[model samples]
Target: MNKISKRPRTTLEQKIMILNHHHKSQNSQAETVNHFKTKYSISTSSFSEWLKDEQNLRSLYNNSNEFLRNSKRKLNFKYDKINKEMDKIVQSALQENQVINEPMLRQHWCKLVSIYGVQDPKRISSFSHGWLTQFKKRNGISKNKKPIELVENDYDLFDSN
Candidate 1:
């Protein structure tokens, strides 16, 4: 008996790449699938599903940043509008040399979510540090950027004392 290696979950970038090749290729589905299997390790079932959702997948890729290619799951757009508002606020805060941290972002997100109301009802009132990380990445906001944090010791953690 041979041990079968589990296939890795494909990111949006990989899916778009594979789909583009598959569509542009002169080869048949089986042939294209074979090529993907050898190169990307994507299974036929996943290919079939991706093909079915081609329109959505392509749209998502178009909306996403190629350089910041998303993780296994696509970006959940429930907070998209909120994200724009937050982007403006972050930019202004950065201009004014405000400290950007997880708690501050969470509190701001809460206020925005309440004021704007949520697009997705299932969306929670609070966001996690992971969500904040993704939000920063998507907006090209760097944590290491000195302008965003004026004081070395000025942070939510240190302020609590």
Candidate 2:
């Protein structure tokens, strides 16, 4: 029996590099596929599959440009920093015995969004109620109030019949 070896998977970066080179060369899609098949031993079906994903293709194209990629990385970093700051604020509020009811939570998030919105309009555009809910869930912030338990000492005081 003959055993067939599986081809190595292509990394996203490699795919991007190949696509960028193909685009710069201004070759037809078929020609590009043929070139990669001959050079890298990748299958035509694989190229077709990769190109079929419109969103991924667009992202790869955008990332191929250094300026666009750097801007995207910076924007992502800003969003991450905003999220971290918001988490700290929420944690501090919880530590201070503040209840995380919908109104209170929404108000807090609105203030944060407004504060950060001045620096980046895109940040404000991405804020939504759903994001708040996801944040709360991620931080383990619960909506239901937990009942306080009485200690044995407190029970003894109440037993003075």
Question: Best candidate, TM-score-wise?
Answer: 1
Instruction: Encode model 1's per-residue lDDT on 1-161: one tens digit a residue.
Output: 99987667778888888888887886766787888675566777878888999998887678656544656776566567888787777777767766776666666777788888665553446675566666777766665677664232344631321
Regions of candidate 2 where Cα sits further than 4 Å from its true position: 1-78, 118-126, 145-161
Cα RMSD, each candidate: 5.9, 15.2
Report every candidate's CA lDDT: 0.69, 0.55
Candidate 1: give the clashing pairs.
Answer: none
- Residue 96, model 2, lDDT: 65
Across 1-161, the per-residue lDDT of candidate 2 in tens digits comes to 99966555555555666667766998877788777764454676766666676466567555433333322222233356567776676667667665445444444555677776645655454456566655655456654544222121232221111
Instruction: Say which candidate scores most in lDDT.
Output: 1
Task: Provide the lDDT at 12 for model 2.
Answer: 57
TM-score of each: 0.61, 0.35
Candidate 2, clashing residue pairs?
none
